[model samples]
Target: MPCLLLAAGRGERMRPLTDTTPKPLLQIQGKSLLQWHIEALVAANARRIVINHAWLGEQIELALGDGAKWGAQIQYSSEETALETAGGIRKALALLNPEPYFLVINGDVFCPGFPIAAFTSRFQAQLSNGNKLLAYLALVLNPPQHPDGDFYLHGEQVNDKPRDADFEERKLTFSGIGIYHQSLFADLKLGEAVKLAPLLRSAMAKNQVFGEKYAGPWHDVGTPQRLYELNQSYDPK
Candidate 1:
């Protein structure tokens, strides 16, 4: 399956640092954020990658080139204006079309050494079981910045609302890592700017969305302080 890395946001919260450099180009532990994901993905043997960028998009192209350095085939889905997650994915559907399902990661978040292959396996396993899931999200403990959380996860099912029954359900923050079927965005028109949450919520209502909590070091890295903290704590080992 192919992977799409979202890198088009203007990074308004990141301010001056992003004024000249795209958010994904911001470095932590001596590697650009985008590079971290690339290295991890390539290490997992996932070689087809599609990166979408708008702000300073060319710089990303210049830096990563053709992905030869990492032995991957990198393609760019350039946008004149930044498209929100769903829109970006919809626009890049052509590149991701060969595969019924593809992986999508938010370019700004930092989660080093994520188990991409494992998640792929889980997704495939579910598919083989004959479940028609449209999306599989990797959820994480809510960060301080987003304590309210995004979605509720009960067992392997993700829901927009908590169930009234007795089973355990915990609301968690979206780690911005997910595997999606191409059909999730089939209703979206190409180039229409749309956020991903609504679509996921819609899928959740139909019980088509599933999630697994990722108990790993993860950071949203939306601000400079968050980036600095991550770098300061990084052991580089």
Candidate 2:
């Protein structure tokens, strides 16, 4: 499946660092966050990459070029202004290929051992079995910043319910990684800013959304302090 890296966020919280550089270009262990994603995607054999950018977008193009060095064909979707998640995906749909499913990940996140191949295999198997899923999210344990979590996962099914409603299950944070069917953005207007949560919730209500809890090293690099902490603790060697 083709991959889309979302690199267009303004990084409002990242301030001075993001003032001149896009968040994905921020270095972690001597490699740009975007580069890390590209290398990992290439290693997984998802070689076709589409990166959509808005804030300092040109720099992203200049930094990564066409992804040839990484053995991938890179295409870019430039937005005049940052199109929030779903809108950006909607705008880049044409570049995502004709396949029914594609992979998407947030650029600013740092997830070292995310099993993209395994996720793809599972999603494909579910699809082939006629179990139509609009979206399959990778959920993680809630981080300190988002203690309440976002969605509840019961077995492999995800729902927008409070954790107290089902004491047996715990709410999980969205890791900003997933495999999505093209139909999820079919109704979205191209280039319009729209958040992905509403769409996911709508799908969840219809039981078309599925998710898996990933117990791996995942960090949302939203602030400079977090970036510094990651760099200090990360073993690049």
Candidate 3:
């Protein structure tokens, strides 16, 4: 499956650091967040990677040209204004519209390892059932900074259940990682500033949104403090 890395956010929360360098270019343990993602994706044998850029976008292109160094080909989706996650994906669909299903991820998140086989297996199986799955969300424990959390996990589904109170407590934050089928945004007008939460919620109502719990080291890396913390965690003895 092709991969689309959403790196166009202005990252308002990560100022000072983001004041100079793009957030995805910020290094964690000597490798840029974008580089680390490229490495992992290549190892998983994902060849075509689409990266979207907005603020300080030139740096991203200058730093990782063509993605050849990482054994992958890169296509950039340059957003003049930082489009929210869904908007970016919608814009890049023409470039990487991975036929049946593909993966999308945040460029700023720092997760050291991702299980590619597990994701591929589930994706293929879900497609065999003749169903149009919207997204296969990866959920994780809520971080200390945002305890309210993002979504609910009932079995393998990730979504909202306003009908039940217990479902609210099943709060699990999105890992900023997901698989997207072209059909998910079939009705979307490209470049429209739209958040995907509503579309995902609609999918959830039909039990089409599947999820997996990944207990791994993942940092939001959206603020200077978070960046510092990640750098310290990767500090070598």
Q: Ten consecutive residues with minimal summed lDDT in candidate 1?
A: 162-171
Comparing 2 and 3 on lDDT, the stronger one: 2
Ranking by TM-score: 1, 2, 3
lDDT computed for candidate 2? 0.92
In model 3, what lDDT does residue 223 have? 85
lDDT of 1: 0.92
Which regions of candidate 1 are displaced past 4 Å? 165-169
Candidate 3 structure, TM-score to reference: 0.93
- Backbone clash count, each prediction separately: 0, 0, 0
- Cα lDDT tens digits, model 3, 1-237, are 889998888777988778889989998889999998999899889889999999999999999999998899999999988778778888998899677688988899998877866777876786786656778988889999879778888766677764486644658889899997788888888877778788898888887888788897788887888788888877533
lDDT of each model, Cα atoms only? 0.92, 0.92, 0.85
lDDT of 1 by residue, 69-140 (tens): 999899999999987999999999898664689999999999987899998999888888888899999999
Residue-level lDDT of model 2, residues 1-237, one tens digit each, is 999999999999999999999999999999999999999899899999999999999999999999999999999999999889999999999998747889999999999878888988888877787877999999999999999899999878889985465466668999999999999999999979999999999999898998899998999999999999999999866
Provide TM-scores for the models. 0.97, 0.97, 0.93
Error of 3 at 180 (Å): 1.2
